[model samples]
Target: MLAGHAASGQAPGTGPGAAPPTTVAAIQQLDRVEVAGRHYDNAVGSTDAASQGTIRAELLKSRPALRPGEVLEFVPGVIVTQHSGDGKANQYFLRGFNLDHGTDFATFVNGLPVNLPTHGHGQGYSDLNFLIPELVDRIEYRKGPYFAQTGDFSAAGSADILYRTTLDEPLAALTLGQRKYQRLVGAGSSELGQGLKLLGAVELLHNDGPWTVPEQLRKANAVLTLSDGSRAEGWSTSLMAYDATWTSTDQIPQRAIEAGFDRFGSLDPTDGGNTRRSSLSGEWHRRTDTGATKVAAYAIDYRLRLFSNFTYALERPATGDQFSQQDERTVFGLGASHAVDHTLGGLPARSEVGLQLRHDRIRVGLFDTQARQTIGTTRDDKVRQTLLGVYGQTAVELAPWLRGIVGLRADQARFKVNSLADSANSGASSDHLLSPKLSLILGPWDKTEWFVNAGRGFHSNDARGTTATVDPKTGDPVDKVAGLVAARGMELGMRTEWFTGLQSSLALWKLDVDSELVYVGDAGATEANRPSTRRGVEWNNRYVPRPWLLVDADLAWTRARFADASPAGNRIPNAVDRVASVAVTARELGPWSACIQWRYLGSGALIEDNSVRSSSSLTTNLRLGRRLTPKAELTLDVFNLFDRRVNDIEYFYESQLPGEAAPVADKHVHPAEPRTIRLMLQLGF
Candidate 1:
């Protein structure tokens, strides 16, 4: 059975040992409310505007995602796009923040953190290629920094993905698409004696994109799980493994493409990557009449070798500017939370406490390369990072129509680095931070509620940046950066279900960061420094007029800028100004079903001066399906329905070409894939 409240607006199940309702009508009564089983609810009178609400499994199954990570696009006001090969992490944009490789946004799967601190590629690097979309049961997302349970990399928002413990029936699927794409997947679950269950899944995939140099991507993934009991009181253990290798087609200079060069051509064919990950995780939960307790632990072994040549021949003209970033690490973490219900001043109340601890031992390096062969090392370091966090929160019902939540959190992080390039740069650093949070919820009058929220959050800097005393390229002294960057946010919002079969929400939010500063260890330099501010508004609507049809629309607009004046101007580079999406889906319509969606990403400044900007991109997709038999189905997906010509990503930078006299500043972009189609066959037993 699935967890969470029923979509039909029925009351949730009572806790263990509770008396069952006498009649079906009593079970469906809206007035008979139960304590929220999960953190948030999506019923008519539940949820605030800052919450996307719980995305049910049925909805996830109805939507068609081109990439596994694109499933997150269901979160309102978020956009996912890719600039390189499919094996790499997708670029993310939300609430006016670029969120490069998930710097400020946090993501999790089954209580396991996805962001990697002190990473080789970028800070808080997040890769989601290991996710198996078909096994996902629910997605709960929250925006802003208003929750105590969220810690690092959650200043922008956070998402928790849950997978089903057991499948109703075994499944097998095969997909074939344009550009030589192929995939095979199988999953199943079996019940053991005395409430024990076993589940397993495996996937294989390959793809060669439309680039002149084929991507030649090959990926393999597997998962195994064991569980017992219900979600409210249960324990589960899981093991996962993933491996992939691919040839990349990096972004190209617009000048070259306009000068008769093939748009799909690559300047360096050796630019690609290989990565692997294996992990074991376990989660346990216990619930009583008045409270609940939960615990989780995980360990991961990961490695990556990435080759990139973004600048052509700019830095090492002789070596063609190609470089390699290697990372090998082991991560371990533990988390526990306890919640109890009580009375405060004769009013209903709840108190919760949580602790989180994580440690990473890593060997990371950056080296100049030619034809995938290392020429000279820029920096190589062995780093150890440890983080500990504890938090407490209380929720009180001040009045029949009012509720308030107050929280406090403290976090400490320690970093130790051993630099191989320069002994002088090796050192240790530590930092601590405190955050306060508050949220006020107003009446559910006429099926609507208003909310006000404010909070503080943070993200940790790379360990190498925090301990460095000198530059690796030049032996010049350099000041160490702060180990943690702080962020503050406030929001006012409302959620309403005043209309029949319709739900709508709106939020006005603002966020400020102390500084947008980062150390680029790969380049042996530091990024530009500037404090930044962002304000945005989002509107989301969902309508289900009929049992078989659903419609959704989300729109957002933002204004972002630097807080201090500078010669380069005040605009924040790559901070998107607007985004919109609309989707319509129909299912179980006499053996025929269909879905169509449209997404738009507005243009933004590509440089600090705002002198150059990227063009907006719009794409439409359609999915059609037919029920061949009771246990079999076929689906056809058409991507880029209109064959739109657009860019997946754009940047403004200086580069030197083979025949250029000096370096030239120009726009570089990765063109979006054109029209394509995929066919899939699914079988269930």
Candidate 2:
């Protein structure tokens, strides 16, 4: 089966049998090593924290993902769900925080950043619809703010998804499912003369979900990559393009459900979105026995048109409170890093320095809409933003049984805004920040190691918020907010492989943020929130009881609250407290393979006062694959296998029905899909 886990081998910190000094070149070399028959890759010695690891392609290929964004679920504590149409960005929850369209989490594909700093939808908005899972080579993830290579939107964690330069065999696949779902994909690679290789993939998909209005989701995506040489010395260039459009079935109020509304019903059939993106990226790296150097650059063009009506008639009784958001942007970025191996005070050591630069030109607008037609404009603005970050890090063997890592980073941001509707809101601002990080590793006694880490990190806020002085929609006086928010984090963790065929890790961590201020693009205003604090514990285990069977389980719990006192109480709304997942896979059982997975998301407070709460949910998925011939195979996938009646997402807000005299407070929810099945036929040459 495609579902498997690897914990990597254990190595000492500073003894005669200790692992090599950690460096960019060494890590790249490690990644090049083949793991053809291995179920998991060893991370015990190569990782600085127990929470850091890599998921290989062998495992990613076998997992059943209902949506493209669900690929991130393999990261362990992360949960991905959608509240609207399939074309919209997926909502993410991790480490007790509702990420809200990818805030506080940094994501990179082929070294190109995915999070947009000043977006029309929200701050740090990220969309991964363009990704082709079949082309991914591996996913490298690090939790917390402990790594120097990461910068903005990394206060929570970061992930780097690397694509393969070549495919083992060419593939063509077709998938069909219930609700008129259809997909066609083709991928292949060719070796050019003189060590050059070209890889390409294309996908076309359509789905009309189990909704009364019919989603009518249409999408097209493609990727092309060209490369020469290997990890020791190589250069590669890639091009990606994606376009999508869909109708929406947004969340409905509980009152509507009680009034004979279908679970897969729509509040506003006109609510939907269309988006397009294209990018060109290049990367080059050279590695030697003593050092390594790498450089990357990218340019992107993006556009989005979205319409949504969340509160119904709460704000505009005459128009039904519908609004539209539009964004168009061009982005350019460059990054370079160098690492050297040397001796510090007669001890083995490695040092690295890096620089990152990015610039964005954006045109964003908001409008009042009715039935997909614009009525009046709320605000329109042209924004120019630039970001720069520089960092240095060093690792030294302090003792035969101890190792230390230290780093420092500096960041600066500048924003210029030209408000088209209100001249008073046009202005320019700049901000800078300094952060420090430290980590210590001790002993591999009895195949176990302990780690302590502390660091400071940050996320950039929307550029418009740094200059606006009045509410765009209400014309009320407002205060400009900071351009960047800071966060501090610390973790104590351990990893052990004392028992044969079993790997385990445990971590205790805490984090504090200076503020939770965010710019609401939908409302055309800034909402300042109080400071917040959070603490959590996690345990992850992988065991292979037999050569044919693999079992993996992960559990996490967190406590989240506002740092300041208030009459409304300190509970941080939507901060889920518990999450768990279990998976079992059986492989090499003749020509048949099978996998089963269970996921749970615990309830959380819905409001600050804790007077209301959301419900928990549990769901299971199943997959079966059979080999039909040497070059052909068939597979079946089942989603929500038990047909549980649950919600994908929930919110508490005020809205008014068609005949209501006053707005009413109630819970709004997007129900999870019922049991569905899909079948696929794959051919390889």
Candidate 3:
């Protein structure tokens, strides 16, 4: 059968009610042109509501990112920033949720989960420094909890980054910037045999950054893939490896900066981190006249060692409060899915069933450190976490202008912890959750659709939190927290493409969680307590008025708070109130192209009482390029074009300095990078 027919069973210009194919091989003579072009478009036209969108390769190429992980900023309402070294994971914010190290937002690349559970630094810690943006084909993102294909760490949203299977041509690029920044990348794909292809890519980078301590970041990344067959029937295997190390300049107290300290100065120069990740993954797929089936599996080896000093002299006046968080782990997972077209009450309907399983074996520890040397141990444990999930979803065309989707998902998680700190804390815990999802889509009137979506979702707590018996610091008794926290979400949204070359979407969403997962920086663990709620409105627009010009805009406003009344007040700390972005791109403008983008992050509460708030920040970036030849180009990128002096991140907490008699509440801030320019040269063969 033609790849498109086997994959989707839809013909050109077909609507949602297209008929199923009669024979698998009937259209085999037809090439897979449609399938190739619709790969990313399918994500946009899928049965999901307006809260979902896709970023294609064209958009990725048009935007210039200060950091590799900033590619995720393409997702509406997402803000990507870094408070530490460039080699570390970027901090993430979405929909009023401070998703510290990716606690509530799931991220996937080429079917491999990027979020790590039961990590030493925090729960669901995700690091995207390994990703090579040039190798990505598209990013599919969904907000809220309305998708059955999503599970843990998906309460707020999820993004699946798909890499390119093959490159049209070989590519080599080199970049140089201020402050000793340098990078080199090479990627290409080649045909091996009939229906077989090979792809490979490598990236290396080093940067001192604009820091008083000199970040001295060094990173290397590589990916290799082998594949055969068409989208209708294909098999692929891939291997990826990444390693990085850097000296971090952690957030500094605003008081110190005001006291004549440099904004980029470091309190503890030894603060830094080292991380490595290697993985092997494979996938198989088959398409029949009735449906399609896919299976995927992956195995990963990961390690991390981070040293941070947040409280300075709060705990140890002479030795400082510096500590180390370490995690070494192996992860294995498998997923299988099958989709079929069927009749529901004699109505055109589609059904999909999927099963997912994952297991993690981890050795995690926390230790007090002075000058990056361990002084004493706090907690050390070996944890094994396993999860199994099953889900089924159905979509039926209820009428010519209406469609309904219903889905149910069940997940079971088991955790076993072997604590070296205290035998009393070694234990096993298990939890199961059942979530139901529903979505209603109405109308295509004038190329517009309205949707209503509601669903339940959850995130797994840190294994240590599930079985802890005592505070490692004070030896005081402590209660164990739930192994899993649940969340519920609802959204009313609309999508419109009535205007030619323009697509727009608006969504009003609300989410409530049974408890918030707070990262205890000093303790090096996640604490689950205090129920929370968030409500927000988002509007996104993309306009392509001409073949060479594109304009895009997105805006979000949110309110987040603690569900229960408290003496400290109900405001959720670090929950941003507003976010806005605008971008304009001119591509292939007669060998000259340009792009300008502006991003805004509004002020937010720094503490529960909301007595102190962070200052809003706005920054702009510009990119100009000139095509030297059909296969060669040069580009210049100017980041923080206006040289806005602002804080990248802010936190309100208690800290004690060298001469202080007691701890005092103050604001800790990481200043944003100043204006800098980078030039890049690219060659294609």
Candidate 4:
């Protein structure tokens, strides 16, 4: 759930129960309709900042995504890549931050939060494997902490994905690709009478990746929803279930690959994971002339069993350094908000207030393992974590050309952890924080607008870390960490549609964190680090030169460093400095459509010191589609269109080989999938 107008202003999809209108061209009752896209979606006056906008479903469908998480790449400056198996959470990078497993970023589907707190693998572990892209209607996104509606894990940014309540037609699709990749999906919506509609979707997939050990991945996912009315006056309930299992090929040391090992080979073939998630959620919305109200509630059941071998034999030469992480949890959440439109001193104004609550009952553990068998327990804990946030904001038209938005948020967190193995490490604690936000919007002159936004935000540390007193592996005293860390950010931006058939924006932003403390879930401890600062500039553009052609380009550059003095150099590890993307799409070209895109990931420091740096990578993807009949279509997708040799992720760390006398420091890399092809036939009934 999001904050009120006072906290974040009148952002898209933030007004009381109101969703942003389609930004692209509207549908026509002709033989064919031109699909909507960001290029056509105008945001000049509707958005509070240049960095915030809606990505339409048409744009999502036009792109070729190798994984579910890659969908987030649609957000400018964000990169999504996998370091391990398909079943695991994808690594994310944004705004000069290596948002490991969803840290400092918030994501929501419909109204259910996707980022899990106190997770076994990592804090705020967000797994989007259950997402069905075709079912998404639109995605509303915002960056920084200038919004009250978003509370935690949002210091960098947040995205809220909305699902369509109904479909234009029923769909059935089958896809087959290289490396034994196969998939089947079916989705449809039906009228249930009396303003009630039912939507259902299901997906089944299998793939054996291009690894020597074979990444035997399998998945089953489904979603069902019942809804009545529209966003301004409606209610909906949904049920979702997803399950996945896969054998993974983790990153291999450069020395091993140079020593005659296959680049795609795995040092530990047994490394893999299994995960399942099921949830029930409901939402209600009502709107009138002067006021509106909305409420959302959800319950979720989730479980995960993951085995990884990152350090090889560095610690346990006898049996290798393999380990297992197990997590099982039940989560409950509720949110409610109300907004009123009024007049202030003869000026038009709007105010809103909201409350959000979430609780997680979790059982999590870390263990030493051989193959997939647990040999020893590092730590086992039962955690109960609760979060409560209340926020309010107001938007006012101070003058003919000036508008202002201000808000405040209060958050309270309670962490209760019971260390099953070490009572000395268990404790209960609570913390609270207050955040304030402000935004100023000036002008719509010449189809352009200027914006200034500033805010304070916070992210919660792991509950275990907030209460731990001793390290589980080493019998040493440990210092507890703050339950909450604060962050401050500001942005100066501009959005314009001054050029015909084009929408472009530019933003200059800066963010500072009080501390870079983090919980090391793999070892069940906290890593206290230094304060940091990040600054960046982003430029995004979209153009439709013709009714059937769309072109888009976006570029971002960031400078990140530790704020405190350190001999290890001030550079932040894995803080990407540059990113760029270009895309061209042609649709309705006489029953044929095509799209091509190029993405670039610039080099960055691999460690605190800048001596070791990663290499930049560029990749291209292409999609071609044709209509077979009024009800049938065919499509072909090529990933890594140029067959580029590149790595998906890279890290510098210490590890030991089976016969090595001692440990060695080297670069570990997971190679990106080579050129691959997929073909699909879709039928509408």
- Global lDDT scores for all candidate models: 0.81, 0.82, 0.83, 0.85
Best by TM-score: 4
- Per-model root-mean-square deviation over C-alphas: 4.6, 4.8, 4.7, 3.9
Per-residue lDDT tens digits for candidate 1, residues 1-685, read 0112322111111111111111011111133111122212455434433453667667777767888888788888889888888888888999998888889988887657888888878888889899998888777777888777788998998777777779999999999999999999999999998999999999999999889999999999999989898855888889999999999999989999989999889999999999999999887777665666777788999998989888898887777998888899999998877766777898777677878899999999999999899999988999999999988887777776777778898999999999988888789999999999888877677767788989999999999888787778787888788888999999998877677767778899999999897766458555648999999999988777776777888999999999999998999989999999998988789999999999999999998888999999999989999999999999999988999999888989998888788899999999888888999999999
Per-residue lDDT of model 3, residues 1-685, tens digit only? 1113221222111111122321112111212212224222421234367877657777777768999889899888999988887777788999998898899999988778988888887778889999999998777778898888789999999887778889999999999999999999999999998989999999999999999899999999999999888766788889999999999999988889889999999999999999999999888877766677777888999999999998899999989999999999999998877778778899777787888899999999999999989999988999999999888888777776677778899999999999998887889999999999998877766667788999999998888878888777777787888877899999999987666767778999999999996656459555555999999999988777776778889999999999999998999989999999999988888999999999999899988888999999999999999999999999999999999998889999899878889898899999989998999999999
For candidate 2, what is the lDDT? Answer: 0.82
Which tens-of-lDDT digit does each residue in 312-422 have in candidate 4? 999999999899999999999888887777777876777778888999999999999999998999989999999999988877777656777888999999999999999
TM-score of 1: 0.94
Q: Give the candidates in order of TM-score, highest first.
A: 4, 2, 1, 3
TM-score of each predicted structure versus truth:
0.94, 0.95, 0.94, 0.96
lDDT top scorer: 4
Which lDDT tens digits does candidate 2 get at residues 1-685? Answer: 0001212110100001111234211111112112223534544555678887777777776768889888888887888888888898888888888888888988877667888888888888889888888888777777898877778898988877778889999999999999999999999999999999999999999999889999999999999999898867888888999999999888899989988989798878899999999999888777666666777788999999999998888778887888988999999998877767788888778787888889999999889999989998888999999999888888777765577889898989999999998988899999999889998877666667788989999999888889999998778999999998999999999987777767788989998999988889888888999999999999988777787777878899999999999999999888999988898988768888888999898899989998989999999999899989988889899999999999998888888876689998899999988998999999999
Q: Which candidate do you rate higher for TM-score, 2 or 3? A: 2
Model 3 is weakest, by summed lDDT over 10 consecutive residues, at: 9-18
